[model samples]
Target chain A: MSKLISCYRGAVDAWECDQMGHMNVQFYMAKGSEAFAHLQNALGLDPARIRKEKRGLRFKSLRTQYKSEVHAGSALHGIAGIRKLDGDVIHGFIQLFETAFDRLSAVYEFTALYTNLQTDEALPLPGDLRDRALALADDHPDIYQPAPFVGTVMPARPLKHMFESSRSSVDVWECDIFNHIEHRHIVGYFSDAATHIMGSVGLTRHTVRSRNLGSAALDYYSEFHAPIKMSTPVLLKSGLMGAKGKIFRFGHHLFDLDSGEIAISTTVLGCYFDMTARKSVPLPEEYANFPAEKVLAKQL
Target chain B: MSGYVESYRGQVLASECDLLGHMNIQFYISRLSQAIWNMCYFVGMAPEEIKGSKRALATVHQDSNYLSELMAGDIIHMETAVLKASTKTITFRHRLINSATGDPALTNISTVAYMDLTARKAIPLTEAMKIKVNELMVDAEDEA
Candidate 1:
């Protein structure tokens, strides 16, 4: 029998889409969050146990590749499985499909650790947990495995020219049952930071709209360094990674203000698309105007 | 054999829980309702086509078992398969499972009649619909 598990099945709600005419990147992270819960369950870390013990599998690193766009009213289903359980870290993946067209919409490849939910402390993998995960682990050669994140990846260091794109305290509602900020909210911060980054490049909603262009995230790689609990003061610093041809890349360092530590490091890649034509287009002329010395790729 | 195919996948929201601290009975049915639509599509009753033709599969009878309590944030999914089908009606069974525990939360069996929305009356199943029903049929004894 295949070790793979069908972990998610749901449709896109109309409200889940943003102005981009398709489901937003944050909503994809939301579904990935739900899928992660189930994957943890399969490893003997069910909800009741986690809520009682206050510990469960938490992602150390996650890479999301958006393959195709899904619109409102689209049905989505996902399958997840452990590729391997090595030492304290378990490698796994979740692939979400657009049911109507039977096409892969997005996939999340992740490395997780059983951790102290409150402290973000990695715990020793329990014997029973290791056994269960190993029993279900497989090569899963039939599934799609993306090439190691295509271009320059983000590092967890504060960059010299990185500017504050957003600063606020986490909200209670932005957390999951674990009381830690949900991955969707973290992605939300990055999504909103797009405006600030664009502003730095001398572009705005008016300028993009005048060109009938819409931006879409093509790939995202995030590394969680520490947990951001509810009400924690947070700050996001961002800098352009690179902008050339039709693609532009940006990097972020999300800081936990109280601890003065980088909570998460993320690299995002995306492109502008002609709204009416529904096709990717060249990076706006404005992107080239950003000071070359300010680009974070210099440090990377 | 087409034993069961997933019809629904989601999480329980905190608001959906009753004062008892588990998911409410109404929410179980609501998730089942979402499953029904997906099951219809599996049986070749594409929702868009049904919407255009003013035809739908309306449940005439149903029975369910709430075997386990579902807490908020619980990841859950449902799998369903056809039990039997006549010219005018099809009976199907859905098994809802808690993704974390791999325990059955609920099992719903529904008998639905093909209906004409405008006329508000049951209608006979089409040949293609019958073919899909047969393709999705599974043995009940083996399911349990």
Candidate 2:
């Protein structure tokens, strides 16, 4: 009951930080995930063995709480412990800490299911696997409810921009190893479309230096009420959620157009960048010259 | 090794391809990683051996490009060549190959650095390790 894995340490790189000089939220989870994978290998339960043994675990949901910002150049460490194991479900607690100063920066708790790798459905853990996991859970017993932003489906809001053309499908090549579309791909879709829209407004990347500030995403969240098979057409719906001064929040939903179901919902917290001073800049006055209603009516 | 150790393999599964099947993207990386790890062990950098020396190769930057589709039952071979070596970094270029017909599957480049986990930063590679790696590099090149 006293098995405690040593902490996994990873240094924050310059590329991992955003323009805001803070570690990007997506990267924070990425670091934890890296540690988790290594931990599995250390447990003698690497993926190949799992595949060959016909047993695997899939992440069902995660609740992450951002306690403090981790700036670039910080040495980040993660301490993971099994919190609870119920039948086929294992809940884990991971704390991201600044190792140099010993300060807690972020906490992530995840719900995962033991399943047949070939079937992707919740299944009972193999007797030996369950025994090992139970031993770990018993040693560390601090269990808490997952955070709000983890697994909950995002609200489906209507689009604010009025655009006539819609993109029906995304190229298959853009999908990353996760089978789920990569996070950057989602941003790429809108960023590319934004450039075109900005063209109508007579703006270019060189003309206006804008930057993404912060973003929140639910990796496993699907808007579709039903299963979405891969390679199926995923229709995207984009809209402006709100804007205040220079700060704007945008919402996006990717759905199965044929099934009329949602596949992914994303909320972006971003701002216009001055690019010169490298500071947050307000939305340029040039935007006022464009037809706000036309640009903000339908999903862009 | 001063020169890279050349090894080759193909991709039989990819992340998005799992959408139609049961495998996930994580597994794809995991399998490729195993192949690489096994090769490294064959070259004398097994985890236990590295742990005995209180040193390990830590991954710093890894970027993967998926070029072609890999379906189940496809045979993929990976060829790895050391690109450069320094006190801290070991750069390798890996090519994924299709063994059935012999074609490229994917290309990935990874930069790993020698790390002292206790201190947690880049450190110099041991001279003995360097000599052994170079020996393996010579053997691999000679075989090629």
Candidate 3:
């Protein structure tokens, strides 16, 4: 196996933390994106060459897992290695570590397609570039582990039982220059639905304060299927997937109301907590009897 | 399956976009957080009730997929529904759509647990509140 190479080194910024008091998920993506660019450079696919050739890489899919929390002032670095190459596509892996304690903080796996910018068509890597990429290809088991739901193929079957949880129109503030919705907002949409669902079950701030309890997410996985444009009417559908002990899982589907196509799929894992004790706890009687199987039966 | 209820509406601002010129992922989550509050209020668990009861929902995990892109100046709306409600936690799904194209820009799924701010422990929904919550469940027979 080829050796891993350093791709990015930086410090966590104070501004990156969210209300939950840890680094927000978007910053993790930003860091991984930068590392991917550096890895491309290491493979000799520099910006100048790509610009001259009118060729570039487009992200086809991404999977990330937050293993540990990083606080502001935490020095961080990323190491990357090529995993596989097939024709015009490249699969890569990156590992992020906090330098202070030298602990793994997160992992990212991504697939990118080489494309002719002018024609927007997939193209194979040049012979020389392919050789260079292969020279650096490695799958270090100690440094990387497969994240759940990364390889799960979305079923093509149509949704049977779905609830329209939230409906919203795109706003100018939510779009990037490419006129596409930003990644952070996609997560925002999911969060909105989660809040509504929790409220529907009396798990609101009012109830929490009265009960001395709280909630927190343990992990997440998402898959992108299509692209959406500005000012499009969107629909989101959701259902229960399953549960194990204190952990519960849920699924969501995003649709473009205009095209009537499924655009995105997402899953989340979460846990209950005791605020005073600051530890995970069991479900209360009121919430313990949810018909998980009934809900799962309705999932697309 | 619950029917969708209109939860929140807003316009995207230019400031929310990243260097790629698309909306930043964090903003999407922030807006959804706002919508959750709106839905809570609509369901009779307004801020006043929260303040009086000292209970709140805290997200434990959230997953999102960006299917389409939305640019600045796009008017966005969000709809939310309950996916599951268990003893300690509940899951929700949200959809964001662009008004001009009438297409879904993104979809999100999130799970949260009820919390007691003072004790910081997981709690159960009251029997009375559970009955009210059942009202939010979608009628499985209804088609989208």
Candidate 4:
């Protein structure tokens, strides 16, 4: 039998759709968060065990690729499997598919490490947990694996010229039982920050609407350096990484206000599309006109 | 017998849990609410048709038994089967199972009807719809 385990099944609700008429990126992350729970259970980290032990798997890094769009009322299901285990870190993948067409919708490639729920400290995987994960690890030659992310990836250190895109404090309702912010809400911050990032480059909401254009992230790569806890004031600094042809890359550095430490670094690759046609279009003139010295890609 | 098909499979979110430290009752109903659409699709009423014709299944009554508590980060899924189908209504059962323990978290019996949205009245099932729903019927004893 295939080592892949079924993880998520559900349909997209109308409210989950954005102006582009497809499920928003945040909701995609939400479904992925659900699938991640199942992945943990498969590794013997059931809810009861995690609650009793106060420890569980925390993401070290994750990459998501939006393959196809699913709209309101479209049914979706997901399957996940371990790709490999490297010492204390476990690498895995999850794919969500459109049930009706049996076509790929999104893919999540992630690496996680055992962590203390309260302290956000990385811990060595227990013997039993390690064995369970090692047993499930497979190089599944049949499954699809994304190629190495093209262009530059965000580094852990803060880069110059990045400007604040979002400022918010974590709310109790947005946290998991561990008091750490959940994955979906973390991505939601990125989603909301998109508008501000665009505004910094002269592509404000009014400008995009007037142009009848919408933006979509084709790929996103995020690296977690520290845990973002409840009620913590956080700020996201973003800068244009590069822009050419139909694609533009933006980079983000999420920092904790109290410690002033960069908590997460993310690189987003995306493009603008005609809202009516839903097809990719060339980057706006402003993208080409942005000062090259200010682009983070230059710093990288 | 292929009488029960997988309907809803997902995880329990922390926000869905109440002060009791378990998934709240409304979320259980919410999941079953989604399952109804899936179950309806298996019973010959596709979501597309429902959206296009403005004719869809609306649960008029349901009986629920919360067999176990599902905590945050727990994975669960539902296996649903048609219990009864008639000209005016369809009765189905969904057994929501905890994935790790393989135990039922909630068992829900829902009776829904195909209704005309504009008229707001229950409608009869066509002959084809009857055959599909009948194909999925399970004797009450068959339910686990």
**RMSD in Å for all candidates:** 4.0, 11.7, 19.8, 2.0
Q: What is the TM-score of each candidate against the true structure?
A: 0.84, 0.47, 0.58, 0.94
- The digit string of per-residue lDDT tens for model 1 on A38-110 reads 7787788878888898889889899999999887656788899999988899999999998877899999999
Put down candidate 2 lDDT per residue, A121-170, tens digits, no spaces: 56777677677777777435443333354222346544545242236464
True-structure lDDT of candidate 1: 0.87
For candidate 2, give the docking quality class from DockQ: incorrect
True-contact fraction in model 4 equals: 0.56
lDDT of 4 by residue, B1-144 (tens): 768888888888888989898999999988897677666667787656654546778899999999999988788999888888878899988899999899889998999998887798998997878988888899977664
Model 2 residue runs over 4 Å out of place are A1-7, A39-44, A138-252, A256-261, A265-300, B1-144
Task: Supply the TM-score for candidate 4.
Answer: 0.94
Q: Which residue pairs in model 4 clash with each other?
A: none
Better of 1 and 3 by lDDT: 1
Error of 3 at A97 (Å): 2.1
Candidate 1 off by > 4 Å = B1-4, B13-20, B24-30, B45-68, B81-95, B99-127, B133-144
Select the stronger candidate by lDDT from 1 and 2: 1
Error of 4 at B135 (Å): 2.6
Please, what is the whole-model Cα lDDT of each candidate in the order they appear?
0.87, 0.53, 0.65, 0.88
- Model 2 per-residue lDDT tens digits across residues B72-117: 4244455666555677776666666554445666667677777775
Interface RMSD of the candidates, in order: 2.9, 11.6, 16.5, 1.7
**What's model 2's lDDT at B113?**
78
- What value does the lDDT take at residue A65 in candidate 3? 69
Fnat of every candidate, listed in order: 0.37, 0.04, 0.07, 0.56
